[model samples]
Target: MHAQHDIVIVGGGLVGASLAIALENSGLDVAMVEAAPPGALPPVFDERNLSLAEASCHALQALKIWPLLQTASPIRRIHASRVGDFGRVSLDASEVGREAFGHVVIARDFGEALEKRLGDVASLTRYRPARFIDTQGLADGRREVRVADAEGEHRITTRLLVGADGMKSAVRSSLGIDATRHDYGQTLFVSRVRPQRPPDGTAWERLGPHGPTAFLPRFDRHYGVVHGVPSEEADAVAALDEAAWLARLQDAFGWRAGRFVASGERSRYPAVRVVAERLTAPRAVLLGNAAQSIHPIGAQGFNLGLRDALTLVEEITAHGLDDAAMLESYAARRSEDRARTLAFSDGMARASSNEGLAMRGLRSLGMAALANVPGLRAQVVAGGMGYRGDVPAMCRENAQ
Candidate 1:
């Protein structure tokens, strides 16, 4: 099969799907290619819970997907502390005069909602169960992509090629873009838990011997727990019985969110930091995990990727997709945000994992300062809420 479009996105995950929906009625033909079947779940939309920034919620509402996500839990407050440390900070939405810093959503539910609304866009062409094979730059500046699917091979030529296929992006590989990967030597295990005292729309984060443990509020008196463990200890931790695991969790996290009485199946993945050297190549650009994948300490990875998708669309909507200048401008616009996010996330991982007395004392002081200083707290809240630099129109103004 042979097809042509204004843009061909090489990953139909959250970021790519969001971009396709955002480009609706823009008079641009967009094709989204995904290795997963139309209704199948991608790895990105598994059991893990997503902490959506205020800006992300706005973007979703504007994209008309928010209404479909009924089970999302609003995070009225966030509690940050260190086990055995004296300093702690709590950020409340009321301080910012907003309803919430963000919302906690189960990724699977969000994915189902996105899939349900995908067809409504009316202008998107989805290549389901499709995998990118290779690409070649054409004389006319368009990029040619070869994709394999159940039906067989297909050739797609597009003015712009988007690499949203995740950390090991085929589009990036095909374009010969090198990405630096840093393994954090830790694995994040996530699961659902029923705490004795239900979460009151409060998300809790504690750094201790077990690494960073977070409990996020969810619907129906349930909470989502993310426990980071050293690579060597992941197996022992994951292999523990529910009671034992819950005990370990209680020890590392304390009873801030109350004792965990029950838990669901555990899911885990090794934490890695990946950053691409170049965001643009010929007529192509990488978005989401393809461009950079960071630790989940601050829950900033997805939000950053969502911003990338929005910024790319904004550039294309203003400048034609085929314009090299547009690609350059897009790359430049994303450079700072990407750099800062990568550094912040990496720094958090490093700082939180260090158990030295000096580091512990520093963290305690930092936490106390963040808790006591209103200005510093606001800055942290604002940054974590995705209000930092080169605000996308979709993020700044209500998405309508």
Candidate 2:
């Protein structure tokens, strides 16, 4: 059977689902193709902690997804310091005329919230447990896509095709788009730990020779910890017992959040940077990890991807998706934000891992500047809260 839609999104993960839901009132017929079965969490949703920027929260609020989140810990303050360094930077949301910089939510919980919100989108048709096979451009400027399911192969025709299929995107390959990959050579381990003092709305970052170790506040009174180790030591670190792992984390992170008493299951993710050569091709476009995937050093991966989704929604609502001009405009609008964010994440990953004396001095100076200069610090805060470049309406104040 053949299906027709204004748009067919080929991934129902975080960014893809958010895009589909944000277009709920756009009066467009949309179809979402997800590889995961109904009621099952997507691979992207794991035990990792996600730091949602304030702007991201606003966008989710506008989509009516934020209210469905059962547990989220607000990040009222952020503290950053390096091992064996005297320079430190502390930022409080109140200093910037905001209640909080952002909130932290577990990836699994956020995925559940997205799944719930997606079910309520009246205009969206979902194809769960379906795999995208291939696509071809049609004579009428639309594209025909083949999807595989248990029943058989089905064809879908759409004015616009979205490749939110993530790092290894079939749609991107079919569109003949090339992407560059950069390996950071670091493995990040994430889990929850019960700290003696508990989390008090403070997010801490302790940078070391290997990578950054972050402690984010969680609603359950447990601290969400991310410890990064060199890629060569990943297996050894992962093999550590609970007691040994906790001890290592404490050693790297210091005693700011107090000693970690109890720990939970651990998850490790290899750090790699993936950026598509371009963001759009013909009637197809890329979103989230399909377009670019950066290091999680600043917890900017999902937040940046969400912005990409919301921005595309705005463009689609303003200008119909029938023309190549609309996609070109979308790509141009995303250029600056994408470049800056990619640079920031990649630079942080490299800088923190460099143990050379010159790099260490530069890091110390940078921290001092961020701690002392109000203007510089404000810029950092703005970027941290996801307010850089052209802000999307859904992420702006009083949106919706």
Candidate 3:
């Protein structure tokens, strides 16, 4: 006899963990298979900085996870400009009738909070330090997942199997779902730095020939820096000493954020975009990076993934996992938001790095329009705060 669950979530990272937390006390048997051991941080919860959109914050709050994040920093304002360009745009949350557009959080800190919250989910069963071996379809239209832990392999049958395992998803592959990948040919470096003039509730994005150099506010009064460079130059740049790298950052970003007087450890990774050809297959579905791994530019990766999780929860609760039509409806509902976000991130990544005169001119004009037009600016602000498409109930303003 196999262990049984109404839902089995593969990957206990941010998105998967969030889903489990949202389903707490919902009268469903849930199981989570995580590769990390107890109290260990997953690779997704490393030193990276995440910018949580306002909608994501609301969803987290609804799931009772936001209050646990004591170190989150609110983003009250946004400043966007291109180096050597006369056009610049500044947006304030007050203009959009909100307290903030979102918050900036360290990935590891958020993960710790998620781990703590997961313990409170009464209906969740966890399989820690486990690897998802494979899955098989049952004659009754259900799925059986094989997870291997220290005690060896265990079989669990589920009405719905969720693939929140991220970029290289095993669940997606087992479902025979194809994904399209695009390499941006760029590398992003992330680190924390103390500047002469630290962040004051403002986030800055400075675009250059290479890519955007972003400085996000952090709770510890330090700026979380994300710098991008050409792939060929990543090694050379990484080899630079702290002082030299700080100097390079200052030169690239200008004195707007002030001089960097001190720095912390830095991590770097190649920027790539991967989008699954489809969102659902039979009794299984994908979320977060498994559905779409977008570029870090615009900071939409996690926010988009969180929305996916929340939306799926809504669908599952409304129709249950046994409803085949509910799965199709979930895919249809997510199509617009997913497509729009992917296009925006990919477009920004390419446009910001293109040195062509025409592209530069267009960027300048766009910035000018956004700066001078309140209606246009408000629309942009709304989208930036994750108000696109069919808004999930938890993400809505009146969501309790």
lDDT of 1: 0.88
Give the per-residue lDDT of model 3 (tens digit) for 1-400.
2798999999999899999998896799999999999979799898788999999998888888999999999999999999867789998888767788999999999999999998888789888889998897775867988888888888889989999999999999998999999988889999999998768999999988788899999998899999999999999999999999999899999898878999899899889999999999888999999999999888999888889988898898889888879899999889989988999899988898888889888999999999999898877777788988877889975522
RMSD to the hidden true structure, all candidates: 1.5, 1.3, 1.3
**What digit string (tens of lDDT, one per residue) describes model 2 on residues 245-320?**
9999988988889888999999898888989999998888999999998998888988999999998998987888
How many residue pairs clash (N, CA or C atoms closer than 3 angstroms) in each of the candidate models, in the order given? 0, 0, 0
Q: Could you give me the TM-score of model 2 versus the true structure?
A: 0.98
Task: Please state the error at residue 363 of candidate 1 in Å.
Answer: 1.4
Q: Lowest-scoring 10 consecutive residues by lDDT in candidate 3? A: 391-400
**Candidate with the larger TM-score of 1 and 3:** 3
The stretch of ten residues in a row with the least summed lDDT in candidate 1 is: 391-400
- lDDT, each prediction: 0.88, 0.91, 0.90
Q: Score residue 194 of candidate 2 by CA lDDT.
A: 97
Task: Give one digit per residue, the lDDT tens place, for model 1 in 60-95.
Answer: 888888999999999999998877678888889988
Residue 114 miss distance in model 3 (angstroms): 0.6
TM-score per candidate: 0.97, 0.98, 0.97
